[model samples]
Target: MRTSRALASPAPSPQEIGRAATLALHDELALSPKPGLVTLTDRGSHADMDAHTFMRSLFALRSYFVRIAELGAAQAPFEALEACGIAAEARMLAATQGINTHRGAIFMLGLLCASAGSLAARGLRPTVDGLRHTLTQRWGEALARRALRPSALPGGQAASRLGLRSASAEAALAFPTLFETAVPALRAARSRGLASGPARLDTLFATMAVLDDCNLAHRGGLAGLRFAQGCARDFIAAGGAGRPDGLAAAAALGAEFVARNLSPGGAADTLAAACWLDRLG
Candidate 1:
């Protein structure tokens, strides 16, 4: 519910812009953690280290939410990492006793990152009051069920149907494409080459490699998402006998953005990924 303007883009350069984004993210993580809860800030402490990591992870919940909510699947590799952490805690909390307090705290943080207002709102206010209703209705129920059922994760049949499973699989397969194809293609297009992105190559590249694969697999129904893998394959190549890259519609917009009329080296690929997800939705 904090009010602040998103840092304007058309930024100095991809390096500068992404650096700022990363710093902002870390800042959010530092400030808004769950009070009196174990967290990353407690790292290296002798006591409650694991609990601290779990809770510290929660403290930065807003950063996680803002990243996913604003960036969508394209740039969501960052968010997915956090989401997985939350999933792990949720599972642990369900099975273990004497940690109910920490369990509820983690769940609230998860809702903050996963629900409508969390990722869907794009740095705006959390709107998916549907989340609040669901939490109120099912959180305790889920806890009770976990006790009897002994299953750690929630969402039942709904999780797979929601496409996280598929996305996870798809993201697995997307590595060759993202690194071999997309990154190379953009580097060739850019005058900057690898120099344009020392920082992003390590973090963003690895993250995008995962996210793109997941988004494709899950078809998580992102906004502005459409296009297929092979659809743009020919376009990325040298002379396709027609257009350079055959990206059209959402894909075309993505390609152009990747080509640098948009933001940075990875921006176009990420944006295109976003466009494709939008179509699925």
Candidate 2:
């Protein structure tokens, strides 16, 4: 088993961070039957966005990760870092025509990029533990303050109404879901000798089963969130992608989610986070 520290190396360059972010987003897009998320074959549960829209959004925000990484390497203040996020969000909206394709990712992955930068600056290797440590050590308090601020996004509002953990709370805690659940799930599947696609599928299901995804609640309320979690839990319990019928079962779930108009964007974001961390190592 890999410890939190893992291996230490020099901080990654801005270009490295940018490449990792882009590939991570691509990995997420490539995963199929992600149960309520967009992919190459279909738009999952979303009607307004498609795979092409996600491609555009990814292209638009590709540079933001690099620039934010530079800021992190420079040790910029949290507000300045957030300003970059706001700009990136606007760019994403512009590309998707006001659609929220990657808002959750912009916050979660963007911070990880910045944290990687900070780690590089401090002469630490950009390992999983390093990124998490930099995020909490350097900006954890600021993230906590941001969590207290009200958000205008429906997901944030819905999370509050449902008494669920908001995205802000996840960031403030340096992403417990990513570190504690998503990453481990990915590693576990790989250790079991599963292929990349299967590993990622299992990882996504693991996150969905536990995460208090605001997007699900925003669209379907608490009932919606519970439904998504149950689906994910059942999938995992049924051997996930390891079973011969797993892919078929997941495809069925995807159809069901689209019909129900439920999307687990939060889980998708964490899945991407896991991809990013794996790539870094």
Candidate 3:
């Protein structure tokens, strides 16, 4: 009798899941020419933070991801997960000396890591759909309630003022953008034989085109958000990153975003979540 291939490989350990989450964030950080976002080589729209600041924050949060995964594997309640996230955010702020480098990632990716852990604990192979299901089944109600509460964060405040979809709402919806838009865009680009760099560029633009990025609203208001969306649409219309001059065009867009101080941090987080899902496979 031959053993099944799925049985031959064990489910990823909690620690491994945590490490993958960290690397997924690094993937987002390394992707350059991201309109109004930070990269290893440039600070796209921020005057207070650079690559070094992000690096410190990443280093600080490494253990938090592992702990959150452990909690998820134990099937802990949403409050437990929220507590872990709150602690992680504090560490990140401390590491970056009060600069919020990975605040959004802490919430979005932290929940994702927890969902993956839940799947692994049940002897289930973590797929995109499995993770989403686990998240909704386990914590969707809590997330919905969270969406109803007032937020003190600048991005959340901006989203409220503009009547845009907040991060909490995205989580309550089980991250429709991450599963529906960003992941599909990434998978499609990769299947089309685009390199990692170009594939991510295409995915980023695809996400930016649709995400109600609160960071853009916070920085430059509704007009700025619309401007970023228009730029993203133009990029996608121009054949995306698959085109010969696609990367060049993306870099130029990044310059324009910086000039206007518009940053699509929400879209960046979604892209990182998609990357994490892809890596889980």
Candidate 3 local distance difference test against the native: 0.91
Rank order (by TM-score, best first) = 3, 2, 1
Per-residue lDDT for 1-281 in model 3, tens only? 89986698677778988898898899999998888899999999999999999999999999988999889899999999999999999999999989999999999999988998998898876787888899899998999999999999999999999999999999999999899999999999999999998999899999999999999999999999999999999999989999989988999988899899999999999998888877777
User: What lDDT score goes with residue 280 in model 1?
Assistant: 18
Error of 2 at 113 (Å): 0.3
- Residue 199 of model 1: what lDDT? 19
Number of clashes recorded per candidate: 28, 2, 0
Query: In candidate 2, what residue range of length 10 has the lowest lDDT sum?
Result: 2-11
Task: Summarize candidate 2's per-residue lDDT along 101-204 as a digit string, tens digits.
Answer: 89999999999999988887766657767778888888989999999999898999998888999999999988999999999999999999999999999999
Taken over the whole model, the C-alpha lDDT of each candidate is: 0.31, 0.91, 0.91
- lDDT by residue (tens digit), candidate 1, 1-281: 75543443221222222233333223222321211112235221123334444444334432433343333223334345346546545545544422432332233233323333222333332222333443334233433333343223332222244443322222233223433443344444343333322212222323233333322322223221123233233333323212323213323434433332121112223323222221212
TM-score of predicted structure 2 = 0.95
TM-score of 3: 0.98
The prediction achieving the highest TM-score against the true structure is 3
Shift of residue 76 alpha carbon in model 2, Å: 0.6
RMSD of 2: 3.0
Report the Cα RMSD per candidate: 20.4, 3.0, 1.0
Looking at model 2, residue 94 earns an lDDT score of: 94
